[model samples]
Target: MFIELDFESDIPIYMQLVHAIIEGIATRELKPGDELPPVRTLAADLGVNMLTVNKAYQHLKQLGFIQIHRKKGAVINSDEMRQADDEFYERLLTSLRPLAMESICRRLTKNQFLTLCSKIFDEIELKGGKC
Candidate 1:
């Protein structure tokens, strides 16, 4: 798996790591049973603290994206991959509402918004993503 981090982003570094991993899974870049690099290795690779990687892994586990085994390391949880609960979807939509509203306020046409979504969906599908 490959991930690049921007320490300057307003979003937390750990959260960025978690999101990157999930996107990898969603994009089918990481498959079921794929063993992720050990936390220390990834932390070193990303030049971030070990704790950051650990926190990201913990969050991934909490979201059912990965499972950590004593000897096997972290493996993608394919069965539940991208299967966020209703509450999660609800919260996601709520979070997106502000951005959508901002786009509309900026005078983006309905077709433009639709086209953007279509492009995103196409890109995800092309990547062999399940969701």
Candidate 2:
């Protein structure tokens, strides 16, 4: 599995990691029972602190995206475990609302916004962008 991190991004590294894993699941790149890299190993590879990876792992586990095991490490959760979380959607909308409103303020049309979303999703599903 490939995970990308943006060091210059405004979003926190841990949160970005969380989203990256979520996208991995959404793209079907990570199926149930697939083991993830060890937190320390991934952190070292990404040039981030172990704590950041741990935080991301903890968040993913909390959201039912992955299961943490002492002996087997972290693995993707089953599909049934990946049900939509309302709190997650609420947080996502809260984060995007400002940017969406800004686009509206810039006179972006609903069709344009929807088209953009569609195109982006297409690219994600086809080209498999991390989002």
Candidate 3:
């Protein structure tokens, strides 16, 4: 769970934590039944507020990436994670809509945008990411 943060970025600290944890799970670095550091401890290590870590954990749980138990705290979900549903796909498209618009506004061709996406996808795939 070595989550690096870019305080300089506009992305919220909580989101950074969320993305890092998701990436770790995707890459198989954090396997099923793995216990994550408690929110307070992880926040201290990351120099972020405990609330930020708490928010990340909650989001992860909702996304089915992790499960939070009363005593067990946060643990990665089962190895057989659920497949994305229609709602998830719709949300994914909604999230990417703005980026697609931005690319077009910048005069990027569809091929260029797709190429960039493919490059990033390959980068993550090489790291054992399931995404």
Candidate 4:
């Protein structure tokens, strides 16, 4: 719920909103069944366009991260979340490939890269994240 947007960043506002919400869920700041602010309200609160918030919400729903209801608005999905399947694994690899390549180009050792990944996992776990 505490989203901070970097207006000057190269990232698109809608993607940043999506990432922030996903991070909130990961950190347990947004638990199952928690209702998100209405799109118009959140847009006004964040000084962003309602369409931006709507786009992010739609993406979240598509990604199975949240559910949208006409009357109830958006809420964190209460059902048990899906496990990583082949599709997810494929997407994960696609996402990580560039980062891994960049790390290699920067001369980061395999152990160092893995250590960084482990550290991130540890931090997320410490914050009560499920993944």
Among all candidates shown, the one with the greatest lDDT: 4
**Residues 24-105 of candidate 4: C-alpha lDDT, one tens digit per residue:** 8888999999999999999999999999999999999999999999899999999888999999899999999998999999
TM-score computed on alpha carbons, candidate 2: 0.84
Q: Superpose all Cα atoms of candidate 3 onto the true structure and report the RMSD in Å to 1 decimal.
A: 1.2
Count backbone overlaps in model 2: 0
Worst-scoring 10-residue span by lDDT in model 2: 122-131
Write one digit per residue (lDDT tens) for candidate 3, span 71-101: 9899999758888889899999998899999
Give the C-alpha miss distance for residue 114 in model 3, angstroms: 0.6
Regions of candidate 1 where Cα sits further than 4 Å from its true position: 80-84
Residue 86, model 1: lDDT of 97
RMSD of each: 2.0, 2.8, 1.2, 1.1
lDDT: worst 10-residue window of model 4: 122-131
lDDT of each: 0.88, 0.85, 0.90, 0.93
Which portions of model 2 show Cα errors greater than 4 Å? Answer: 85-89, 127-131
- For candidate 4, what is the total of clashing residue pairs? 0
Q: What is the lDDT of residue 50 in candidate 4?
A: 98
Over 4 Å off, model 3: none
